[model samples]
Target: MALLVAGAFFMEILDATIITPAIPLIATSLGVEPVDVNVAITAYLVTVAVLIPATGWMTDRFGIRPVFIAAIAVFTLASLGCAFSVSLPMLVAMRILQGIGGAMMVPVGRLAVLRYSDKADRVRAIALLTWPALAAPVIAPALGGAIATVGSWRWIFLVNIPIGVVGFLLALKLIRGGPASAARPLDWRGMLALGGGIAAALIALESVRVTGTNWWQVATGTAVAVVLLVLAVVHLLRTPHPLITLSVLRFRSLRITVTAGSLYRMVITAVPFLLPLQFQLVFGWTPLRAGLMVAALFVGNLTIKPATTPLMRRFGIKRVLLVNGVLSVLWFALLAVLHPGLPIWLIAVILYVSGALRSIGFTAYNTLAFADVVGDDLTHGNTLNASVQELASGVGIAVAALLISQLTPLVGGGPGAAYSATFLVLAALLAVTLIETLRLPRNAGAEVSGTRIRRRDR
Candidate 1:
């Protein structure tokens, strides 16, 4: 069961990261600029961001098995469509559909695992499930680059088809059907407002990059996004059974967890996106070389996985997070000092170390975030965290790209200057997370049940 669930998790996350290296190839094939090709990536991420909030409701409305199967089908078919897309716009549209499929895959699959798993096994299950999410980005760029170098960029999308097909079949056969939850009224209004707000905000951010931050356009988009967001908040406050269930916010530990989780993910998000670009644009490395270099992140993540649980037990969450967060920030800052003259192997080693530290830091954050939630709130808290996680990732990448785009010209497009400036900025942003980490209670880690959930918990 864990294997199936983890497979699904890996597929979703792998698709998200794999497309990064393919962007340049995609651009050339479609007769579009590389930056313009990023629209496909952004479209998929934004679609996931917009749709993820609704997954819990969908799972409740439809049985988990059916929903998971349908999600896989959609994602698989969309991957086929993406491979066959003849133009950039067509590919972007296909990616949005793919996003819709992926949006439900992780949370719904996770909910299934959590629903069935015993309390004692829940944390371990979650930790195991998170490996693919951690590992995907590590291997994605290298894999994507290799595929693109050997075949067409279309192979990246095509690769998902076989995996998705297997997943769908396995899900149908192995996933159990259960008595459905009583249907609660869907929060249609709340969904509209929340979805609209998030979509608007993401579009606004993307627009700032595409439209050069023209005051009028930026101001108008920002205003629209703010108004939509405000409306969502107001709706959440007034609605009976809001989309996200605001009552989840009442858990102090959960509150801190979600807040810190968002900030932490935001910082982690900047690394993969910026590092590859830094290697290619700054150090004049080929896409494949840059991707191979970036694979150090996965190495670190993999190496640390065996130790994450034990380390959390030893140092505790607060101390672990505080020390690790500071170290992670320093890792980001170190990139600012990297130059073309530096040995590539040395840089890879540094990144490898950073990746290990980052993996430990991230695992700690995720485990601690849900440590305090119990019973019904646990489900809602998990849903809310999933939504925020995706949102933070999208926003983080957008923000980093926008900043780097602006800084590049100012740095005279010299070797490593733009990359240095961007890394410095990211380091500064990460430094703020140290303050957030301190907000966790000293004994918070000790309070966690540290139990793994089994199939019956739901």
Candidate 2:
């Protein structure tokens, strides 16, 4: 089941970002400015962010089997719609439709894994689910770039057809679940408020760029988003049955994941998105070459997985996170120094290290999120975490795009200096998470990691 959900996750993330390296080609195909096609990307992201809040309710009202399978079908069909799109509006519409399916697949699928997996093996289960999140974004660019460079961007969507078909068939045989015995009534007010806030927030972030940004639009969206989000938080706390139970956030470990862990996620997620574009645009590399270079992340992510469990068991989660956090800051600083003249192997080495640290951080944070939550709180925790993760991913991409655009001019060198400055800024932001991490007790997540705290530590 973890593998199944992981596969679905890969498909969802791949579809969402497959256009990243091909953005220029897509703009040309649609007969529009390259910047205009950002909407197609943001549309899908905002739709997914908006719809994610309701999936927990959906999985409970309908069986997981039904909801998961339906999502796969919808996602697959929408991919076809995206392929056949003749205009920007048509592509954005199809991507939005695809987002609806994505909004359902990940949260529902992850919820199933959480419910079924034994507590003793939660680390293992989370490990399985984490790979797609780490690998797909890194790999999608290479795959998309290859397709676009060799042929047309349309083939990117077409590729998902077979994967979706196989996944749908296997899900029927492997998945088993029914609606919860006591399903709570849908909280329409909470749902609308939360969903609206997320959409507005993404819109506000999406509105920012280096050139020709509508300041009025950004301010209006920001103000409306702040109002809606506050209302959403208030209503969720007061409602008898909120769309998502905010109370689950009371757990300290869980709170850290949604807060500091999300910041970590947002910063790391932007690296893969920014690197390829920087290589192609600034370094004058072909899309295929740039993407292949970024694929080094794949090697690093997987190669380090076997060692992660041992590292956690030996040093403990808190210790591992602190060390990794320090190294990540250093890693981001190193990334800022890249130039076209650098050796290819050296660049790959830096990316590989980035991937390894990312894998470790994800495992530690994901496992920590569930370590202290028991029984009933688990479901809501999973739902809330999933929602936040999706929002962070969307915002990360939007912010990275904006930063690259805005910082280039302000930094006063070129695209190269802009990317350099962005990495340094990201490094500074990650350093802040180290402060939050410092506040965690030494033995944090010791249960999941199976690390024994020493008497001296106590």
Candidate 3:
């Protein structure tokens, strides 16, 4: 069951990143600017951000098995739609559908695993579940580049068909239907407000890059987003049952975790997106070589996973988070100093270390966030965390794109300037996590094993 959940997660994460290396090819085939084609990427991310808040309500109304199966089916079919898309708009639409499926697949699948897994094994269950998410980015670029170079870019999406089919079957066989809980009325009003707010904000962010910084269109989008967000906040405050329970924020550990997690993902997620472009466009490496270079990140992430549990047990979550958070920022900052004459192998080595440290830092922060929550709140907390993760990833990419676009002119409009400035900005963004992480109580994970034991008793 853990393997199935992880497999589903891996499939989603792999698809999320695999398209990046092929972005240039996709742009060329569709006769669009490379930056313009970012819409396809942003569209999927935005859709996930907007739809994620609805996952808990969906599971409650439909039951986990049905929802999980539907999500996989939708994602599988959407991949086919993406592969066959003939126009940029069409591709964007399909990706949006893909995001809808992905948004549901992860949270609901994890929910199933949590509900079914013995309480004593919850920590290990979560650690195991995260493996695919950790591994997906590692493999995505290399696999994407390999597929794009030797075959058509369409193969990336087509490749999911078989995996999705196997996942669907495994899910059906291994996943059992639990006793159906009473369905609650869907929060239509809250959903509209939250979804609208996220959609408007994302559109505004994307508009900044799409219409350029000075365009009135960007201002209009920003205004609309602000209005929608204000209304969403008001709606949530007044609603009896909000789409996202406002009370989750009241938990101190959870609050700190959410803030730290958002900032952490914001800084780290940008690396894979930025590095591949840098290696290929700035360093003049082939897509395959760039992909291989990016693979160093995965290697680093994998290498560090073995030590994560022991590190948390030894130094404690807060200390480990604070130290690693600062180190990860430093690692990203180092990229800004890389010169054209630097050795490629050295660059890979630096990236590998960054990836390892980042994985360790994020894993610690994520696990600690839920260290204090119990029972039903655990499910709510996990769902909220997942939504925030998606939101952060979307914001991270949009911000990176905007920064790169702004820096392009200042850096002399070449790949070198674009990547250097982007890396500097990413490093700074990551540094902000140090502040959030400091808010964690000194003994935040003090009862770590107790929390595991408690989950088992439930």
Candidate 4:
């Protein structure tokens, strides 16, 4: 079941960025500027993020099995739509449909895993789920570059067809979820406000990142987003049945991941986004070459999987996060010093370590998040975590893009200088998470991790 969910997770995440390398080809084929086609990607991410708050409701109201299978079918059909798109509008529409499917698919699947799994086994279950996040982004660039180089960019979407079909069949055979007997009514006001706020904020951030978007529009969007988000929070706190139960956030273990852990996710996600562009624009490398270099991160993420659980169980979540956080900050700083003249092998080594650290850090937070969130709290906790992670994925790229744009001129140099500055700034921001980690109890998350015994024996 976990494998089935992970496969779905991989396909969903893979489709998100596979078109990245094909952006130029897609632009040429559709008769638009490359920058304009970026909407297709943003549309998918924003739609997914905005709708994720409703995952728990969907699963509860519709029953998880029917909803999950429908999501697969929708995603499969949407992939076909994306492949056949004739223009930018068509592609963006298709991407939005894909988002609708994904908004239901992965998180629902994860909810099933979390809901059914034994507490003692959550570490393994979450670790299984974490790999898609680790492997998909790295693979997408390299795979997309190869496909776009050899064939039509449409193949990127076409590739999802078979994967989705297989996943659909597996889901039918394996997934078992029934609707809650006493599901609460949806909080329409909270739903509208939260989803609207997320959409507005993402648009504002993306617009700010773009070179020529009007400041008045950006300001208005940001203001509206702030208003809606504030309203959403208030409604969630006071409403009979919020889309997501805000009370679930009172769990410190989960709250830490939602706040500091999310920041770390956003910051780390930017590395992949920035590295590919930096490689092409600065090092004058081919897309394929740059992508291949980034694969070193994948290698590291894969190789380090075995040790993550053991390390956390041995040293506990607080120490693991603290060490990983400190190292990740230094890793970003190391990336800040990268230059075209640096050896390729050295760069690969650096990225490899970065990926290793990334895997460990993410797996730690994900596992610990639900350690203390048992029973009914698991539903809202899972939904909230999934939503934040989705939002972080989109915002990370936007934030990276915005930072580069603002820093490029300030550096008074070139793309390389701007990139260096961006990495340093991100490192400084990442350092902030460590402060939060420092305040956590030494034995935090020890129960699910089995570190309590280790600490006692020592």
The TM-scores of all predictions, comma-separated, are 0.89, 0.89, 0.90, 0.88
Tens digit per residue, CA lDDT, model 3, 156-255:
9999999999999988888765435775666688778777767777676666652335567667777877887788778777777777765777777788
Candidate 1: tens digits of C-alpha lDDT, residues 1-458: 66888998888888888887777778788997555565677678878876887776787787788888899999999999999999998998999999999888877888788888899999998888978876787789899878877898899999988898899889988776453568677788888888777777766666665334666766677788799889888888888887886678787767766777677777687687777666766677777887898898778878888888887777677778888888888888887888779887889888898888888877887787677678987777877877777778877777777776677678874736877888888878888877767776566756562433334532
* C-alpha lDDT of residue 89 in model 2: 89
Clash totals in order: 17, 0, 2, 0
Better-scoring candidate (TM-score), 3 or 4: 3
Model 4 accuracy (lDDT, Cα): 0.85
| CA displacement after TM-score superposition, residue 252 of candidate 4 (Å) | 1.9
Please say which candidate is ahead in TM-score: 2 or 4. 2
Which residue pairs show collisions in model 3? 119-455, 119-456
Q: Model 1 RMSD to the real structure?
A: 4.9
Please, what are the lDDT tens digits per residue for candidate 4 over residues 63-119? Answer: 989999999999999999999999998998999999999999887999888888899
lDDT of 2 by residue, 1-458 (tens): 99999999999988877787777778789997555566777778767866776876787889899999999999999999999999998998999999999999988898789888899988999999988967786688789889988988899899989999999999998877899887778889877887788778767777776678888999999899899999999999998887777899889999999999999988887787788677877888877787788888766877888899889999998999999999999999999999999999999999999989998998889888988999999878887887777677767777777777778789898779999999998899889999889999999988889898898876
- lDDT computed for candidate 1: 0.79
- Candidate 3 similarity to native, TM-score: 0.90
Write down the worst ten-residue block by lDDT for model 3: 449-458
Give candidate 2 misplaced runs (Cα > 4 Å). 1-7, 31-46, 86-89, 107-139, 165-182
Model 1, residue 179: distance off in Å is: 6.7
